[model samples]
Target: MQIDLQNSTLSSASLQKSQEARKILESRSGSGHDFLGWLQLPEEQSARVQEYLKIAADLQKLDAVVMVGIGGSYLGFKCLYESLKPAVGTPAGPEILFAGHSLDGDYHRQLLEYLEDRDFGVVVISKSGTTTEPAIAFRLLWSLLEKKHGKDAAKRVCAITDGKKGTLRQSADDLGFHSAIIADDVGGRFSVLSPVGLIPAAIAGIDIYSLLQGAMEMCDHLRNDKSDENPAVQYSAYRNGLYEEGRKIEILVYYQHAFQYLAEWWKQLFGESEGKDGRGIFPASAGFTTDLHSLGQWIQDSERTIFQTILDVEDAKSPVLQNQKNDGDGLNYLAGKTVHDVNRVALQATRQAHADGGVPSLRMKIPTIEEFQMGRLFYFFEYACGVSAYALGVNPFDQPGVEAYKKSMFKMLGKPGHA
Candidate 1:
């Protein structure tokens, strides 16, 4: 959990504001031990989740697993898996697959073809009984599982849903699937701590408790760390100040694809929290030198309405380019410079470019990206989003828009038109 914040820029007064904001976010979170106060929950949420995790862990003994979820569901756990890599928790963690991302029939058919006899299982993550991607994929995958594990194979199914009710919960219950967990009092996007995220990582064999411990620790740090000396508070204050100054969109641009999930994690944290009533920065992500080819022109010269937070890492484990066999098209001038060097230049160069363009740019430099530090980063963003949203007078813990879409889709799909 040792994170290098040396390259992070913050001033003393900004630290003081973050402290005030932290207190405000803590108040909104209320007294739920594990679940942040976003939605209503049953008392059995924690109890149910633990049991389901064991089964998810059991499935890791298989050849592979398919996670049926999208958005926050895929984003958070996918992040944990990619960052943690082969070290995901249990001794039996299996190879993992993520499907249902697109509705393309050929893509789904391709996944099924590759996984036909692979001895894989599915973990459907939807807090409610319905969500188009995961829900449909769940039925499709469940049928596949039923063929593999048998009709009584429901015994092998695991879920993360409401403890009392919901389509997924009721289905798991009716099917006698004894191993699913419920995500209570929290919305899908914010359910990273709850089973919406945990089970997939558990199946991947990730150290989820460690992840939660990291989150809780950062929560305490942000809430209690108070001052410019405290990195979370300092940035929260600075970002909020910019928001007040009319920076309506928070652009989180990064230089690495590995860090792409970091943006996914941030988008939900910021969007779900701050997007309320009429205010909050629209949390968006783009790649460094890459997106610059696409979005940079606009961000630099267009109507500037963003405060860019660049996630810069000083060191990364990347393959170095060698000039041992340099074929020249004037490319020999760049011969000795490694690709990592190129990325390093891009990181610093982009910051300068944005700043010179009159955008209030900020950079968060991580010495490196590893699980322990990524754990630190995830917790940091989650707590900061919570603090920032509360300061902006919104609940940073739910996704109303997501549920609205599902309700409408369910009704339409339930009727004959699409049914």
Candidate 2:
């Protein structure tokens, strides 16, 4: 992915700050340095990624696969799955489904009933193995699997959790289910390059090798390149610079619909990583034309505290030419233009309009919507997130504030000690 900072409101001072920040990161002296396991994940966990491919092959015979996870556990997989699915709509393998991301009883119930007569398997992911949503979803789904397949359920079930501990690990061992380890140093939000994400991507028929290759290449580039040339450093600096200049909210705009989940994953990554000490910029996302009608008004005129980071796909896979029409719609000028051309024009117009309205903008031009590009994009944001949080004088890895809501909910539900 190529990043364009020309439209951003960053000055030379911000670039200097980013250079210093890059030094701090490389020296491993910044906050939350111990959690840098994700920095080299693509290379370090290559063997495990291969194992995920083998498991995915075995699961291909099933009708569907349910991945039980929440938050970071599933967001990356969701993005990967949607980004790389079969372009023809006919998947070569089992359909992958997600559960445990929400607490809605009816949703889980319907999912359970939907799988009653189908051949399905389960892959449960959790660090503690007792996170409320996944744990509950696992219990319901496990019972159904065992009832449907009896002793054969053990062959279909797998667990990706704490390597040496966690309720899920113990359960997996006791029930004789296949298991993968989530290392102690790798935090949930950063586990996309780990088995937590690779396993699901593999099952969904994504190209894990290409994905890792892209990420590994990006890692090397970010590590060796100068701050001025490194996209991650440049992005962190610009974002922090805007934040300091009263741009409180950063809107990530995607012209492609497939990137909706990518935006969701990005929200969690930045939100959980930097939202401490009340000093981080609020991360928001929107799909062009869809959200332009809804949120565009506010972004254009409501406040000057908003900035935009647009994700542009440089080469579209499919192109459609506008049909010539003499009707009074005044669209004849677009007769020879492709849909992609129109979208590009819309993006440019939006950038110009927002910039003229005093909203600073940045753009990330991706080569295409493929696994390699997606992997690079993920690492780019991950590296930038770490730097941005440290630059804000906060811990980039921990999410202490997230527990407050869980505590309240657990107490209200009278869940043991929380009550």
Candidate 3:
């Protein structure tokens, strides 16, 4: 992966701040340092990753697997699936479905009804085990599984939760379910390289080893590279510089539709990590060409407070030719072109158009839509997010503001501890 900041307004001072941020992250001397578990995570969990692969291989024989979790628990796995599975032709893993991310009655009812006829397994993830959505969804789903499969249900259930504490851990022990631990030091959003994300990917037939390898390589490179050459440091510097220049919103733009969930994961990573102290670039996303007709106008001509970071795929998975005989659509001057060719031109045009409209932007060029590249992308963004938040002078690992909503939610729902 490569980051191009040709249009970025970052300055020397921004570079210095990024250098300091790097020191802080490398030394684990910054705020939220306790959650730095993700720094060397890929290398640390090598043996456990193999175990997850074995379990995933076993679960692959099932008809479907319902991964139940909300927020960080589910987003990373979903992002990996959305981005990789499409390139893999037929999905090699079980039909992976998600629940507990929402509380919509009809949604869960439909999920229940959908599972009634199919043989499925369950993987419930939560550090606390009592997060409203996942907790409720797990209870309902486990009941259905037990009713359908009887004593065999325990073999099909897996839990990734707090190691020795939490209601989920106790329940896993009581129910004899297979279990993995989410390290106390790893935050959910950053736990993608951990079992929380890897197990689901393995079950779905993603190559966890290659993914981790890519991340490990990137982690090492980013830690040692210079601010001028390191994509992570440059990315952090660019965003922080832009933020200082009155750019309060950063829109992550993608030319590929498959990257939608990737964007969602990114939103959570940067939003949760940096959005505090009345600061942060409000994270937003848009799929291009489609959004070109919808949000295109605003992004092109709206306020200048917005800057864009575009994820550009270097090559297309499959190419379609514009036939020379198709003159009905106007003389086919582009008859020899592939769809990807047209798309590349479209992207260049869009970038130029947006730049002329007063938008400063950066581009992250992905070599291909493969596991290794995806791994690299994940680490790149994560490392940059850490540095960017630090350069902004905020804790990059904690989401203190997130608890406010939970408090109100629990009180409204009449939870026993709310008062």
Which prediction has the highest lDDT against the true structure?
A: 3
| Residue 108's lDDT in candidate 1 | 84
Superposed model 3: Cα runs more than 4 Å off: 87-90
Poorest 10 consecutive residues by lDDT, candidate 1? 38-47
- Estimate TM-scores for all models: 0.81, 0.96, 0.97
Cα deviation at 46, candidate 3, in Å, is 2.4
Q: Whose TM-score is higher: candidate 1's or candidate 3's?
A: 3
List clash counts for every candidate, in order.
Answer: 9, 0, 0
Q: What lDDT does model 1 reach?
A: 0.68
Measured by C-alpha RMSD in angstroms, how accurate is candidate 3? 1.5
- Which digits, one per residue and each the tens of the lDDT, describe model 1 over residues 1-419? 33233333454555556666676555544322244652222122334446646777677777887887877777888777766663334434576888766677887888888878788777777677566677777788888888877876675567666778788888888887644554454555665656667678777767665555555555556556554556666567767777766778888888877777768777877887677777778888898778988998988887767878877777766666656454655566666777878888887777777778877776777767664466567667766666666656666665556667656776776955444
1 against 2, candidate with superior lDDT = 2
lDDT tens digits, residue span 368-413, model 2: 9998988898888888888777777788888889899999998999
When sorted by lDDT, best at the front, the candidate numbers are: 3, 2, 1
lDDT of 3 at 332: 76
